[model samples]
Target: MTTTATPLALADVALRLRPGDHVAVATRELRRGTQVALPAADGGLVVTLPLTVPRGHKLAVRAAGAGEPVLKYGQSIGRATRDIAPGDHVHSHNLGMDDADRAYEFGTARVALPPAAVERTFRGYRRADGRWGTRNYIGIVTSVNCSASTARLIADQFRGRVLDAYPHVDGVVALTHDTGCGLVPTSDGAQVTRRTLRGYASHPNMAGLLVVGLGCEMLPVDGLLDGLALAPGTPVRRLVIQETGGIRATVRAGVAAIEEMLPAIDALRREEAPASALVLGLNCGGSDGYSGITANPALGRASDLLVAQGGTSVLAETPEVFGAEHLLLRRAVSREVGQRLLDRLDWWKGYTAAGGGTMDNNPSPGNKAGGLTTILEKSLGAVAKAGTAELVAVKEYAEPVTERGLVFMDTPGYDPVSVTGIVAGGATVVVFTTGRGSVLGCKPSPSIKVATNTETYERMREDMDLDAGRIVTGTATVEEIGEELFERVLAVASGEQTVSEELDLGSDEFVPWQLGAVT
Candidate 1:
C-alpha cells in the first residue's frame, strides 16, 4: 500500500488515503468549479471539480486513459471504462473490473505481532469444555421450519419481566430457519444445516438448550444430537411438535421445560478470564466510501490488538473479499492455509457461474448509493476489517474455529448468514462495521456496531455504538479510535447490553447458509 505523511484536517476539502492514489474522496459535496487542495502526500496538486461530487464520492486527481487501471489504497481498484479527465468524478460510469489472475506468494509478507505489553482480562463464564462465554443465553433451536412457530411461542413466554429473577441469563432466543424437510438427508444442504444446528446446541455461550423438531423431517432430532456433547452440567431438553400433540401442547411443554432448567442455567456466574479467551467475529455491511477509510480500518486495528493479546479474531464474508484475496494470501502463515482459501474461492467461482452470476455481482444498491462503485472497490474496503495479522487458518462455513490469531471463514456477503456462520464457529462476540447503517445482532453473542461516518452515526445514533468518522475528520487518529473500540469490546463482553440487545433484535436473524435444492 502507498504510504502518506500528511495528517487530515477539518478544513480539508477531500482526503487522499495513499501517495499515488488516482482518486481522492470528497469530505463534503463540491459543486462544479470548486477548487480542492490535494493532500501533500498526493503530490500537493490542486484540482478543480469538473462536475458536482457528492459527499463520500470519489474524484479523479490524475488523468487516466480508457482501460487504464485506477489506483486506490495503492492497489488497482479497477480499469477505467472510458477516458477519465483529472477533475472528473470517478465512479461506475467510468470504472469497471476484469477477471485478471493473481499470482500467489504464500508467507512472503507474514509478520508475527509483538506480544501485548500487559495482559488484558474480561469477566466471562467459564464452561466445562475449557471455553469461555460472553453471554449466558438459553437457545431454542428448531430442526425444521415446521416447528419454528412453536419454538417462537415457547421463547415468547419468557419475554418482558419473566426473566427478571435470572439476572445472569441473557434472554431465551428461538433460532429458527426456513429449511429441514424437503432436502435430501445426504445432500450438502442437509449436512450444513445439521452442522450449524449442532454447533449452536453445543455453543459455549449457551447456558441451556432446547431442540424442537417436527416428527417427520429429513433432519431427525435424534440424529441431530447423536454425537453432540454440550458443556458438563448444562441443561438440555427436546420436544417434537407432532408427537407432543401439536403446536400448542409443544409450546406449553417447551416453556415448562425451560422454567425448570432456569435455576441451574442462571446459577452460572461470570469470572475474570484472560483476553485470549475472547473470539471476536469481524464483519461489515451497508458500506459507503468512508467504510474502507474509517470504520473498516479502525476495526482492523482493533482486530490486530486482540490478536496481539493472543486472542482469536474471525473475518468472514468470503465473497466480499473477492478482489482483495491476494492481500490475505501474502500474509498466510503457510502455503496450506493460503491454498485452502484458494480452494473455497474456486468453489465460489463455479457456484456463481452455475447460477448465471459473477463474483463481481456484489456492491448492492445500498453500497452504490453510499458511493462504492464495484466489487473490486468494495472488496478492497471489506478486507480492511481483517487488519494486518498473519492469516492463521481458513475454515468452511459453520466449521468450528479452533485456531487462534486471525482466521478466515468462507461465507457469503449477506450480513445475517455471514454472522450466523461465524457465531456457529465459536465467536463469543462480534464487531460489525457499517457505513450507510445496519441494525444487526447475533444471539448467544453480543454484536457491537461501529459507524464509518459521523453523519450516519449521529443520524442513527440509537443504532450505532461507535463512530469511526473521527479518523477522517482529524479529531482522532486510527489508533486512538481502534483503542477505544477494543475497550468497547471488553465492556460489552462483561455482561453489558449493546443497542441491538437492548432492543431485543437477534432472534429473527438466525439464517443458516442453505447450500442445495429444496426438492
Candidate 2:
C-alpha cells in the first residue's frame, strides 16, 4: 500500500491532497474496473475502481472497516458507515458525520511571517476619519424596506449620465435590504439591521451618504444616526417619504441632496497608500471538492502574503468553518482569542439546534451535487482561505476589524450575507473563491472571483477574475498563483474595475444577517 516514488504528476488526472490521506479525488469521471495510478513514497501503485467515480468525487485508497475514520487532507473528514474496499466510491451513501476528539493547543504553531520582498502600494482615497477606501462612492442607504424603491429611484437618476461631471466619485449606489420593518426595534433582528445600516452609512468608501426612510418604521434614519455616532461635519443627508410629502417628493429631495454634495464628493482624490491600509475579506461559496485542493489554498497563500505585508485579512462564514475550527484555534494568538471563536461555535450549535437543524446540515444541494459529502469535508477546505497566519482576533458580525493580521468574523454561510458583513467591517477589497461559478459582487469593496477548476473558469470567464485552476492543471504552483492574486488585489484596489463591478453585480447582493424572529 506504500511506495517510495515521487508524487504523481498533476497530469495524472487524480490527486491525494496529503500523504496520510486514505482517499484521493478524481479529476475526471473514472470508469468501473479502470486502473488508476496513485503515487506512493516508494513507487507507483494502481487501484482498480469497483464503481464509477464522478469528477470531484472521492475514491477510497485503502480499505476501511465500518465506523472507521475516513481520512482526507490528512485529517478525518468523517467515518465510514459500512466497510469500504479500496477504490470504492466514498460519499454520503457510505460516509456519516461523527464528532471526533481534537487536540486544541493555542499558539503551538504561531510563527511570525517574514516581510515580503516588495513593498507594495495602491492608489486609494484617504478619508478624514483615517480610513483608506478603494472606491469613492456616494451611498444611498434605506432605513426600512418601505423606502427601498425610493432609494433605488434616487440612485437610478444618477445611474448613467447624471454623474458624468463628478469624475472622482464612483457611481451612486443604493444599498437596500428586505428587513428593517415588521420587527420590534428592541429585538435582536432590529439591532442587527440597525448595526448593518450604520456600518454602510459611515463606511470609509462612502465619500457622502443619503439616508432614506418611510418615517414610521421601527428602524428610523435618526435612530440609526444615534447609534452610529457619526462625526460632526461628515457629509450626510437625510430624507423621509412620510415627511417629504410622498414618494415622488422624497425622490426629488434625495436627488437634490446628492446633487448638492456632488461637488464635494468629487473633490476627493486617490493617493498612494501602503498595503497595510488594505483590509481583505476572504470568502468562498458554491464550493466543490476542488475548492480545498486549488483556489482556497492559493487564496490562503495570498492571505499569508498580505499578512506578511502588515495587511489584514478577514475569514468569515461561522457555520461554514464549524468542523475546522480546531485548526484555527491552534493559530490563535492567545487563549482568549481561541475561546472567542469557540464561543461563536457554541452559539451556532444552539442556534441551529433551536431551528431543528444541525451544524452538519450544510454543503447545500449544489455542494452535494459537486461531490461534497459532508460539512466536515467542506469546512476543512473552507478554512484554507485563512492561510496559516495567527488568528489575531475574532469579532462579532458587522463589527469593524481592527487587528492588522488575519481575523475571523462570525457570519452565516450564505454568500451574500457573509460578504455583506465583511464589507461592513471595512474590507476595501474582497477575493471570493468558488467552484460552482457564483457571479457575486459587493459595493464599496470590489470583489475578485477566483475559479477552482479550469472548466468552470473557462465557462464563466466573463465573471471570474482569476484562474487558480492552473494550480491543479500543473500550469502554475500555489505560491506563483498566490503572488499573481496579490498583484491583482493591488491593481483592483488602485481603481481597476473587477469583472463583477464592470457587470454591475453588487446592487442586489446587500443582505444583512437577521438574528431574531421576523414578526
Candidate 3:
C-alpha cells in the first residue's frame, strides 16, 4: 500500500490502497481528458478520464462488466450496477449493494499476540467493585422526562464554582433523556431506558448518584434500583417530584442531599492504575473516503496497542457494519461469539425491513459529498477501527462490557445515542474520527477527536484533538500515530483535559437509545 500527500496535483495523481485494488482514489479533482496511472500489475496501463472525478472519489482502474464486484482495500465494496469503463467515477450512480451471503469462519484468523514490552499506567480512581474510573463526578439521573428539569436544576446549582471546595469531585452532572413515560413498563423502550439509567448510576466514574423521578411514572426509582440489584449502602439518594410536593421543593431537597454527600464524594482520590483498567470506546462520524485509509486504520492500531496492554476497546454502530460483518466474524474468539454477531445482523435486517427502510439508506448527504457512496463502503471503513484484535465478545445495547480486548456493542449510527450506549457499557474514554469534522463529546468519559484529512484537521483545529491526516501526508505511518494516540489516552485518563472537555460539550450529548413504542 502507498500513501500520498494531500492536494495532489490535478495533472496526474491517484492512490491505490492495495496492490489488488480495482479502483484508485483521486487525491485531487481529476478533470475530463486527464490521464492517470494504474497499478503496475496492469503493465504500465494508463487511463484517460471520461468524466470529472471529485477529490476523494474513486476512479476505476480497469473496465468492469455489469454485475461484477468492485474492489477497494483488496475487498469487495459493492457490485457494478452497470458496465464501468476504465477512468469512470465509481459511486452510487454505477455501484450498488451486493446481496450475496458471506462465508463466515469462526476463529480462522484468531492469532494470539504477545503482551506490550513497556508497562504503562494512568492516575485513576479505583472503585470498590474493582472497576477503575478516569473521572470523579456526582450524577443526577432522571427516571422520567417529567423529572428531567428538576434533575437539571439540581445539577445547575453546582455547575460553575460551587464545587470549588471539593477538590476531588469533577462536577455535578444531570443525565436526562426525552423518553421515560408514556410507555408500558414491560415494553422494550422502558426496559432499555431503565437499564441505561441504572448503568450510569453505578458507573465507576460516579462518586454518588441521585435518581430523580416523577412519583407516578412507569419507570420509577424503585424499579430501576431493583433491576440494577444495588447492594445495601450503595452511595445513592432518591427523590420524587410529586412526593416532595413540587419541582421547587424537590430541587431544594435534591440540593440538600448533594450538599450532605459532597464531603464523602470529594474524599475519593486518584491513584496509579495499570493500563488494564482502561476501557476505550471507538467511534467515527462525518466520514469521508479518506476515513478508511487514514484515521480508522490508525485508531485500529491504537486499539490493538491498548489490547496488548490488557485493556479493553469497544467498536459500535451496528448498522454501519452491515456489509463488513464477515471481516469481524473471522476474528471471533469462539463459534458462539461469531454467531452472536451474525444474530445481531439478522435482527437488524428484519428490523429495518419492518420499518420500511434498508441498510443502504446510510451514507448521509454529507457522507456522499465526502466520497462515501454506499453503506457497504462505509461499513468496510468503519470496521477498521477495531484493528486486527480477536473479537472477544458481542454485547447488547447498554450491556456492560466485561471482556477485555476488542468487543462489539450494538448501537445506532447516530453519534450521541451510540456513545451513550458505549459510556453506559463502561467506556472510560472515547476516540472519535471524522473527515467532515464532527464536534462531539461524552461526559464522565473524555473524548478525543481525530481528523482523517489534513484540510479538515486544519479547518477544525480547535474541535479536533489529533491529526491522523499526517498518514495521508506521508509525514507519519499508521503505527506511529497509533502510538501517539495511545499516549494521549493515558494522559487524558491521568487528568489532562481534551478539546471537547475544554469546550464543555458533553452535557447535551447524553442521549440513550430508545426502542419500542412510545404509547
lDDT by residue for model 3 (1-519), tens: 222333233225667887777788887778777766655666556666778888889988877889999989878888999999877999989998877777878889887657999889999988877788999888899888889999999999997777889988888889999988898888878877887888888887887889999999888888877756443344788998889989999999999999999998788889999998899999999999999988999999999999999999999999999989989999999999999999998899888899999878898999999999888889999999999999999999989888989999999999999999999998999999999999998988899999998999999999999999888778999999998999999999988889998887887899999888887
The deviation in Å at residue 438 for candidate 1 is: 0.3
lDDT of 1 by residue, 13-106 (tens): 6777776788888888877766666555545666666778888988888778998889889888889999987668998899998567767799
Cα lDDT, model 2, residue 48: 67
Clashing pairs in 1: none
Clashes per model (N, Cα, C within 3 A): 0, 9, 0
Pairwise lDDT winner, candidates 1 and 2: 1
TM-score of each prediction: 0.96, 0.96, 0.95
User: Model 3 segments beyond 4 Å from truth?
Assistant: 1-12, 227-234
Off by over 4 Å in 2: 1-11, 39-45, 227-233
Q: Which candidate is the best by lDDT?
A: 1
The TM-score that candidate 2 achieves is 0.96
User: Ranking by TM-score, best first?
Assistant: 1, 2, 3
lDDT of each: 0.90, 0.88, 0.88
